[model samples]
Target: MTGRDHDHVTRVMRTVSCDASAARSRLAASWQRSFAHHRLDPAAAPPQDRDTTRLAEQEEMLGRLLHVASPRLDELFSTIGQSGHGVFMTDARGLILRARQRAADEADFIRSGLVAGGDWSEEAQGTNGIGTCLAEKRPLIIHRDQHYLARNIAMSCIDAPVFDHEGTLIAALDVSSPRAESDGFNQLIGAMVSGIASKIEIDLFRDIHSDRQIVLVGDDRAGTALLAVDRDGLVVGATRSARIGCGLARQGALRPVPLRDVLGETSEGLSGAEKAALTRALARANGNVSAAARALGIGRATLYRRMKRLGISGAD
Candidate 1:
């Protein structure tokens, strides 16, 4: 299979789970009661707007998603197999489309009713990273004690919104973890969640974008990119810096460019060698930083520092 094919296959393999039925049932029940059960301090909150009002009545949205979801709800199920992480997806309406956690860590989150079908707006769930990010359409990493609610203070969640072909928000992907783990781990997992959202966006646009040219804009400093690709990586959507690094264009939209070509040459701005070393170490360690550091003959703290310096993140 091709690389893109490989990527999808690997994702499917990594995300398959056996307990999806139980998880779905739990999520549905949670969605039914999230609003009624939640008690927010009105004096400490901000004013609500039109979108917030619409999100308040999400029972129908939840029912639609649960009804249409069948056999294999790939998007919904992906969150469950996140390797000890917690994830939930919400639509533009802020209704929970799905919620899941690694089987090993589901109990604590389940107890808090942070499951599927729940409303997760700042107004409903307080100042949670997921709720706030969705409300504001920004990326966030809310650590322990950062959450507005006392019960949520011990939890950490990193969330990003997913947009469809028209840039309409289709869902929000979030990874929730306990605060005791390294902050680095949370960042990494958040990045992974963003990657998944990006893929979903691509999928949404794949049909209409096949003929349109794309320009790829890479932010070397952030280790991220604004990719505009056709069937193949045709660098059609790119920032000036990305075009300069990849030798594309400066003015109008350019032709399609392959990812291989665009990523073939590492610009002087990016420390490619160091990034490769870090990725290799992490792979060898099976995503365990402490083990990877030992294998690489470095201290765990040193490895974390280097990863942060390199902008490398974990799965959370």
Candidate 2:
């Protein structure tokens, strides 16, 4: 390397090391781990492609993610293609499920094995857009020199997460393109990618909870988050937004909890939705209060008192 280029690399490395020590940013943590744990050399060209899943395995991976993502991929590709960006979808593990780019852009991606069946997890690629986004569980942009590998330093990547009906991070949607010195368009690209990811997540939620009442949750801070409330007014399922905005995230994946808890609303105020839920449960249980109460996710005694207040009459 020229003396000037070598000095710049040394400066960036020292800065990253200090950033890693301070733990001030997710990007720093990822870079530290890449260098410390994965033994990647930021100054060197990227390592060779890691082992990819076989064709048959790729089919299985596609089968799981495609239905939920298929309806929107074409439209997203059209938009991104028009803007000269290549888009890719990856499963939770960062295995590429699908990718699209203009013919010119497509060639290099394929040559680099950034195609379907490729694994781009953090451990494999070291601080890439798709890998780092998954590691952080939030959408982000990884631009140019931010990439751990020298080979990827010419590309900028934008990625967003996709959650299932239960609020599990099931997919990552990403866009990649050549980075210019002063493109000044990462935010616009991030917004577009985020919108597409949100649509895919909501589509999956609606399909999974077609029989339930889906309510919009966040507005003030979260913008638009969706949740499904049962007849008892208990939260049954939630979109990624609702989970984040309403603070309904469980320890693991999606778990149903009472709406009163999630919304912080008074029990009396929830009577309408709760009563309707009880009515449906009672009808389904053939007027059995015991079964209805159980279905309502409440104690029989609690259900009885609630029914009394609501003037709901049903046989025990």
Candidate 3:
């Protein structure tokens, strides 16, 4: 994290905390509706359209984050598996760029072409993660009945907003499934996606503050994280494992700390050369499989298969 990232975190924290406060007040005075049978009808409703001004704002922000993307998104999608859940990447304005789903669900969204050019607005598609997250600019988990559609009541969702160098929202990474209860894997996946967005923001910040020192703290309860820093000692980016391993607090800024000191005993736990090789692969390829495969002397598809065996996602 550079000074800019720190500032962004601080601002976002304040904004969110305030939003929570406001929501609490509103909730106290209003009826707390149960999600058990909640539904929203798109028909007999007011006309709704995407706000072009807002779309433009979000597009500019997204461009910054995408500029530093590792290009290994497809690999990450495969490592996590596209079954039993729906993973999607969207621009800030709620247009779907890419989506992954379970085989059965994939077929459903595929037909609608919602996996590609779909517009996922609460008004257009009814209340959903991709739309609601962009609308509210908040991290949220909408489970089962929380959906605005009666038909969608069987599904659950979790989403987080991605920001850029200027603290502007650029995109959202979200996951949806038919699970009744949120589980450990959901927590792990949500955390991983959030870290990726954070890394992109940090990377953008580094270019602006090339002389400042920053650190990124990550929570590593389940996966590996790839941390990157510039010559200025600022944390430019990190993989899922790094964030979780470090147990980074939400909205917290990481300061420069020696990797050895941060993962002293844990380092011993990860001594296998193969693990090291995979980690190297992720870094060398900027998290891209094709690049990593070329460098590692393996086929692209083989690299994906190997990553599965290694319990790693993306290039790692």
Candidate 4:
């Protein structure tokens, strides 16, 4: 290794060993995990190329999510591609399934192990944008030396975790720049990545539960709070934000909780109560406006007006 490489490695080792306050900071804690749990050397060789068969399997596993994220990836790349940034999407295991980079910048990112099929899990690559975000299950920005590896210290990476319809973390969306940039710029890119990730989750949830009644549980501040309700008014699926905001289960299959139970009858005031009641009635009546109106002791026209006022649509 060169003198500068040795210096970088020395600093990383010292930080991991002597930094008692490392536990308090997310970056330091990740460095600690790299040193202690993963036992990764800051100056270790680049990660090995993944097997093609295994990568294909992972791609297949992420089929639906990949379909939903394709356009968003293109949209993100369109904004950042000319600025020396590369967009990458990795599966739950941190294997890059898809990547987008300008042809001129491709070699640099490839040399930096940012190509498709690269293993970037925290265990494999230390505290990187993709690995650490997946490890923590949250959005993050790892700029320059924030990366645990000396080789990766030149790039800035922003990442956000993508959860499946059941609120299980299924992938990570990332944008990386080899060119040096300010933290402010990195934060901006981070926000864009997070927004795209949320959009992908929302799209995937809707696609998977297309037949079910989708209910927006909270405002944008709640971060895509969406619940998929079945014909019987049972919540069959929820996005990650909805799961967290509504106190639904975070892992595995949801227990088919009632829409009313999840939303709470009085939590959102009269409007919420009315919306839920109309939704339940419509669901029970199989989207028949006349039948649902009769069940609710209201005329069809009145029910239609109420649905329109509540921003509900698609019922017969």
TM-score winner: 4
Task: Provide the lDDT at 87 for model 2.
Answer: 86
**Can you write out model 3's per-residue Cα lDDT over 1-316, one digit (the tens) per residue?**
3454445334323433453443664221111121111223312132334455654555565564555553434545665654566667778767766567667677655543346456665545556666677777777665654444444455666788876443456677777666565566667776766666555555656655555544444553432344555543235444333554655432334565545455553443444446667667777679988888888888988878877877888833
Instruction: Please write out the lDDT profile of model 2 over residues 183-266, one tens digit for every residue.
Output: 458888788889889888778878778888888875634334787877656778877667767776632455678776788865
> What's the C-alpha lDDT at position 251 in model 4?
70
Question: lDDT per model, in order?
Answer: 0.57, 0.76, 0.56, 0.88
- Rank candidates, TM-score, best first: 4, 2, 3, 1
Give the range where candidate 4 is weakest over 10 consecutive residues by summed lDDT. 45-54
Error of 4 at 144 (Å): 1.3
Candidate 3 matches the true fold with a TM-score of: 0.47
lDDT by residue (38-109, candidate 1, tens digit) is 444322333222344444455354444333332223553474355555667677645565666666777876
Task: Score residue 282 of candidate 3 by CA lDDT.
Answer: 73
What's the TM for model 2?
A: 0.76
Per-candidate TM equals: 0.46, 0.76, 0.47, 0.84
TM-score of 1: 0.46
Cα-based RMSD of candidate 2: 6.0
**Model 2 Cα shift for residue 15 (angstroms):** 3.6
Clash pairs, model 4 backbone: none
The lowest-lDDT stretch of 10 consecutive residues in candidate 2 is 46-55
